[model samples]
Target: MEKGLLYPVTNAYREDQKLDGLWDFKFDPASEGEQNGWAKGLADPIEMPVPASFNDFFTDKDAREYTGDFWYLKKVFIPQHFAGKKVELRFGAATHRAVVYVNGQKIRSHEGGFLPFTADVTAAVNLGEENIIAVKINNELHRDALPAGDTVTLKNGKRMVKPFFDFYNYSGLNRSVHLLAIPQGNIYDYSTSYEVSDDQATVHYQVAADSDADIKVSLADEDGVVVAAATGQKGELVVKNPTLWQVRDAYLYTIRIQLVKNDKVLDEYADKIGLRTIEIKGHQILVNHKPIYLKGFGRHEDSIYAGRAFDLNVERRDVNLLKWIGANSFRSSHYPYDEQVYKLADREGILITDEVPAVGFKMAAASFLGGLDQSFFDGDWIDELYKKHIDQVKDMIKRDKNHPSVLAWSLCNEPDTSTESAVPYFTKLFNDSADLDPQKRPRTFTLNEDDTFETSKCLKFPDFYLLNRYPGWYHKWGYEISDGEAGLRAELDEWQNSDIDKPIVFSEYGADTEPGLHKLPSIMWSEEYQIELLEMFNRVFDDYDFIRGEQPWNLADFQTVEGNMRVNGNKKGIFTRDRQPKAAAFYLRKRWNSLPLDY
Candidate 1:
């Protein structure tokens, strides 16, 4: 069954009770939670809030950098009215891995940290009585996992995570949890695809539910008027004078679906959709048949207190900042973000390039460590990682396929595409995703520095190319700025002359700048240097017509693994961690606000 992890909404047919706020928490360093019966209750546990990371809550080093099993226990009452309904516990996300338990009985387990999962507790919960919900979560990173990393055992026998990527390892529930009371045989999943004509649009929809009932679908305008209606499990709704969803100017239509038996409603679900089409024509990206130039930043969910946690207040602030800076789109870099981010983007008319957590692949991580003697695809680990990678891609698409703001699917970021082995691997991913998504949006992956136009073998799989180039910052530093510009131009000339006919997007390019650091002539790590670097990149970008989008490295400074290369964290953001503007922020704001949407 193609059941989607739909956002639990409280409506006439459903009840959603929040299981957020404080929960009893404790660390199980020895992994003895199951043996010692900690699932029944956590002994001497401390209060930890749901939807927040536990890393920065304490001042001690061990607590902040812990790597082991941690448990959270919450007691909730199951109302007697829900006795005949299907009771389930839905988690927005659990970092890395999680296993849920109800009344000391294991319910369900899930891997991959960025997507939602559920546990059917209808048979386990005591009706009209208090029930214990225990969740055991682990935050270990290994080469076989997504966002690959290694665990180092210190001499003291404690474990520490040595991540292949640059980001810090922050773990927790990270998002809200809820207790849902739904009808026993309800709408499990639904999908919508659009076909726009000159004046009319046809929306094709498919629904999966209990086979005993009949399905009815309707399309409505914002004014509470039904535009089209159909009766069946699968059908099409035709509407006249459709308003297509646009970048920064959105118009959404509501799709209400009902499951009926004998002319009476058994269950119903309502969701908003924007009727838009995204495609690539020649060297341009088109949304609703018009070309668009994407202007935004690659942002992280990290914040002052909420390290990678899903906070609506923080999300709203980030969106408002994007509007102020005249950005119409952003990429959820490295991994998928909370579902609320996509819903907000849909309402605000902001575009998104959704990505899975298939980062830090074999070749890139090996290069980062030192050098690899063999091909990246020659290991047993690669086979396991590939299986895990495909699962994440499937789950990510299933959850995010319906969103109009998601214009593309980024399969993986910076894999080892230089080798011939990567061709078949990425080919399978691109081909499979084409069948999985109903919208059939453009698919691509971000390219690293080593995957040059001449060396990359998997470039043909994607509809467009996304490059992460750091010319002045990582290549030519300090006084050698002119050389960096010359090198960048040389590479651009190669791409322009290459046989590839796809559009190019500068997915990442930025310099790390201290907030108040300044130099007269613009040295590295200074605010002036960042502005100079951006200007140089923009000049190079304008020289080529195939260059369609420019999204800088980050929107705000974020936490990273401790090293001499990072100053407390990565300082490549145009704003501080608290979302305060840097000198580069104003520079980009002026540039982006003046540029046309189709530029």
Candidate 2:
């Protein structure tokens, strides 16, 4: 089995069958699955969907709040088409972590669940007959994991999750699962880089294969006309007067690659690519050497019923809503979203800062101020956490390096950087991640409220600054509007004088508002207050020329861990959870529509 992440595609040499449907599931609150031989089959299993979170589908609170080992079993059949072919089970994602067992034998174990993984189950399956596949999933968060959190045990001997992050801990098979069949000596992986001249663009490509063979590549435009062709594992293809992939106006080219020997094609792979360039020149983020002012929201892969599952319908609706609001870009806040989401972004011409799942290293959840503990960096678990973090980073870059819509790599979101240890930690990480991508896109990490201009030790690490501030909402709530504005100005003044010339993007800033709740004199949790707070932030943003972008805290309301701070879920979304417009939606639409793409 080749150990590379190549997106599964259907062609003459490959076929993908989605293994998404109802499956036998059982919750292991006592963690007795392995000991009881449950990996072979769950004795008394309940029916659940494969590509969905089991939390919201259940009626009881225990099932919805489950925080331990769970098992899913599904029966699959391998088609009889002779022999000597490669077959694998590819999971788009399994929440937190998962271990696979086929026909009562352990196949593979994967960690860090937001990315894709494949297990070569060719030998374990019975060709032309039914085979059993069992997966054991664990959702207990540890300090040594990405998006760090703790697993607490109660006096009743039940386990629960206390995530350092604010969002709900939705777990299970949250993305599509597919059974893939491919020929031997298939194309394993590929990457592309670009160089633009006055009227031409040259694309540099490198392909990896399981066996050494003659590599042939061709680039085709929208009209199905081949613009460029090359023969080699690594070569360049030049197109005259190339149509650049612009923000909100995307143009894509199809790249087809093949492995050939003695005039016979052994394997073929095709993917869509957009040629563009992104860089930070002084205080502006330039796309194709032109400035871009991002007007969007920090989005989550969340919705009702599906939870975090990759729902194409919801994804389409969200992108349409963003376009309706005149948004040009968005950050995949906190974690890497579904791969299909990025593909949609490429087609729709939406810019994205593709982030990894490295969120919430803070010591607390409710307030960033109270998280003063440096044990997250100083503890013995730091190395393990960093290793897992770098592993996820490598996976993220490998999976998404070629997408033109991805403008930058957001390394972390709101990580604790108050201590001196953050200096070396982030320095090494930033350098390592920069080397992984062929384009060498700009790298950034969102700064929390605690990591101010003077307090942040890793301020100089990123190519640009992505700050998540809640001046009016978190710092100065209620009638202290003037004080919040003054505090915001004070912070901006300090940043301006700090000699940091990097472009600044307000990655997250918003207030939670109840739908239809209003008051004559605006108060917290009221729709009027949410609008008032955002307008205040916009005024301050316009005063500073260094501010390059504004993506409010959220695109829509989403579920969060149950607490007194949250009612049902986080209500900070400009749109309601069901994709209906809130008052803030219209306000943002008016403001964003007036701002040009280059503003």
Candidate 3:
């Protein structure tokens, strides 16, 4: 099996087609699809949208939360012109796990679902003839899977996926699908980064190919003039007066790579790169040798009907909201988002802390570290889960390493890093992640609040600190607002006196506020209480210079597992589910807008 490309380039520069719209779907509850030969295609199937989750479309609650196998069928005719070229079927993403078959012939089986995967179906399908494409996707989160969980069948025959994380398990073909053609022995993979000195920028690049071929690399300025060119498998190109990619002032250069043999161009690829460098220096995060503060939110890939599917309209609106709130950065909380978001971030100069979807290590939903019994390190499936965790991190870095907006890489979210057993697992995971990326970007994890700064076995591995704290909401109860503020200040003071020299980011802060709820004196779950909590936290940020960044718990309300503490889903967003602003949103906008661009 061939390895998938690091950055999946489309034939959009050439010949490609979007395999989106509607397709036939069926649920294989008995897991008898293979024995019954459903690969040839289901005889009669229900109509399902190509890229959307099948949960909300169904009326039966049992079907909405079904934990078994579901099949999707689509038919296509490969044009005769694609006969000589290498034809491939690419799925943007299929939840948890998937198997693809073309014309009743098995093509590929992929483990992780959040990243794109492709199968070289050049020999599996006949050109100029209609071919049946069938995919069986499963969202069952056993211990060996990336997002680990288990399901239980009730007496009513309803399958319920237990909550290990704080997000909904909306599953299906949750991203786009495409069919593209590329020349054989083309530019298989490449990586590029820049180093700025004085007024000049040097681009160091490497290209990998199937066979020995002449590699041509060019850097075109924003004005469409080729500034520099190189010929080799790996080399450097220097450009003068490079326009550095800055916050809210994005400037990019186009890179054109070509494969040439005997002066004949066999294949070509084009991408954009930002000429800038980022590093962490002395409790300060610097970009292009200047310190810049991070103000954003921990965001999720969620929508009303699409679930985790990528929607361009939603993407535009979300970015607009971020701009309105004066935010320039966000952590890809819990998981890496769709690739389109990364592209938009690059274009808009939005900084990102890219994260992998290894989210369920805590096993406890509400209280932090309450599920030591369900901790990832002590599980019987530790070896298998650790391997899967490593692969997920590698896949995330390889796919997202080229993007300029990605400032850091998060290994996991809210995991128990406080145990002795977690030491070797986290140390090896962070080391392997660094080995995978050529640039070796900053690495960190979302430190659970239960883990103290001094005792956390893995905190020393992160380049900086990303903490999830809820002072006013969670702890120091049975007290007035002043007491809550005092408790929070004491905690910060302890962290400051601990003499840890790393820059810290308050990754998760803010209270759950229903859109219209209000209280005169301020109370939990009300708009006034949410604002009060944030204002109190804001005071601490002003006091501590090491607090380099602040990203609230969430940007908008999103769906999660059903529970009594949650109303429909988590309501901790400054904006409502439909994109309306809450009272806290107004206060947050005012505060963020006051910060200077360089802050």
Candidate 4:
């Protein structure tokens, strides 16, 4: 495959096209012999693509849900012209744990299911000939794994432990696989720090890699002219007075770092780093010393087709929609999103709040009423959970930290009924945030409509206090036509007078209604009601100086198999599952863009 092409893995039997079918297969149980023995058998194995699950390929329905050890193999012949070149095997993403083997040699092993991993296998392959590559995937359910435990319960009362979230978890090599050719000791990772002041700008650059490599680093202007260059220890380099990147004026500059060894250029990588300062003072988020109100929505990485597979076209479509509606920011809600989304946001000049997928609690009706057990939050398992959570967060930051669009790193979303213990969690997260990027913005969490809860009130002095209030959607009297506006107004007034004196954000506030399912003029789920509710909130938001932003309940409708009244899961999205816009979308677009009155 080419360097940057995106391929998706899907169920081979389904109508959805899949690329995983082209792979070879095997099954290696924990009781099996050494991993090397399996690696040796890769030359002649059952051929299948990485896009399929064992259940998808087998006739037995019972095996469809089986989670255990499985081996996948594929063979590719290297071109003679690419001989002696540094070849890296890159897996866009995999689930749980994966170990890669090349021609009977274990090359690399990676943990964490969401982030990308690569292994340099140039020495293990024979150029100009067929090479056998095998990958071992272990999908066993472990309580220590992130998003652990059974999320969905079956009608037969059988509970299955899976990576449960609001959307479907389509496991396997669900992303892309590629073989990239580069020189040795190339750019492994790079960090860019911009110090912008009134008169001048300075940029600190750090690059990491293998020993004593001659690295050439330079910053280029918008017109592609070199502005600065420096050579330093190991692979570190710095460039000062680089052109600063700002919002609105958004002056962007590219830093090109080339790795050379023995007078031959090995690898070259370029990054677009933005130089600007962000500060929050007196309920205002200032970028480059100017107050900017954020109008945005929370988004989940789910498509009608591909499940969690990353699609560049789909990401671009979502960003275009946000831009069309005059949105300047996005919240990667519930979990961390694909790196491509963050890159697009930086290029398009949108503010972002990247979140870690620490969304706890069982969402069943019985579980909701009974509430999450406090014991679940306490134990030795809690430490492992926090470690896994922090690992995921660090991986996300490492991959997307250079992008200026990211404004804050949200620790977690509505961590189950916040208690005094929650304070320590946030405190630890705050310390971690400082360790990762001290110059970046602070971290925060959201407090939904449970003000009476001590945990909610105690989180007042946090970096930012976000409220997810949907007065007309969840209140007892919300269904009544006469009480809708009055109830919302009263709630807003009460919240404004609360003891918390920090930057406020309406993190979530939208009603779920099936698209094209129009109701009479008086119903809460009606098209008229959705638009009216948003307008009422917008008016109230305009009057409040403390509320710095408002992200509607969701950007698009996502999957929830647990059937609800309106539709499957929450239907409260401006767009449908297939990404069709609702009638209320136009009103929001007009209001956000400050377009002429046309309602």
Q: What is the C-alpha lDDT profile of model 4 across 1-599, one tens digit per residue?
A: 11121122112110112223377776554426243577656435666555333434455633444456667777777666555556777776676578898987889887666666777787898888988877888665454565554434468643333433444344567566767665455466677665666666666777765546677787777788877777653232234554555543356677776666788666667767677767777667777666677788988776654555667777888888988888888788876676678778878888888777665422221232234445334445667777877777777677667778888877666554445555566567667666676356757766656542333524643577667776777764245634756655666566568765567778888877767667665467666677777877787787777778888978888765343343555677888777778888999898888832111
Question: Native-vs-model 2 lDDT?
Answer: 0.89
Q: What would the per-residue lDDT of candidate 2 be over residues 425-525, giving only the tens digit for each residue?
A: 88889877778899989998999888899788888888999999987887788899879899989999998887779899999999999999989998899
- List model 3 lDDT by residue over 1-599, tens digit each: 22545445664334668889898999998889867989898978998997888887888887888988989999998899886778888887899889999988888898887888888899998888898999999888776677767667889776767657878888888878888788887776788877997689999998887656699999998889999999998999899878888877888898889888899887788888888888999789988888889999998888898787878888899999999988999998778888889899999999999989888776554232134365567778788888878887877877788888999998888777777888888878876676777776789888877766765777788899898887776675324666877866777788789867888999997787887887788778889888888888898899998889999989999988877667888888888877778888789889899987556
| TM-score between candidate 2 and the true structure | 0.98
The lDDT of model 4 is: 0.65
TM values, all candidates: 0.98, 0.98, 0.96, 0.81
TM-score of 4: 0.81
Give all candidate RMSDs, comma-separated: 1.5, 1.5, 1.9, 6.5
Q: Between prediction 3 and prediction 4, which has the larger TM-score?
A: 3
**CA shift of 468, model 4, Å:** 2.9
- Model 1 regions lying over 4 Å from their true place: 363-375
Candidate 4, 576: how far from true, in Å?
1.4
Candidate lDDT scores, in order, read: 0.88, 0.89, 0.82, 0.65
Candidate 4: worst-modelled 10 consecutive residues by lDDT: 9-18
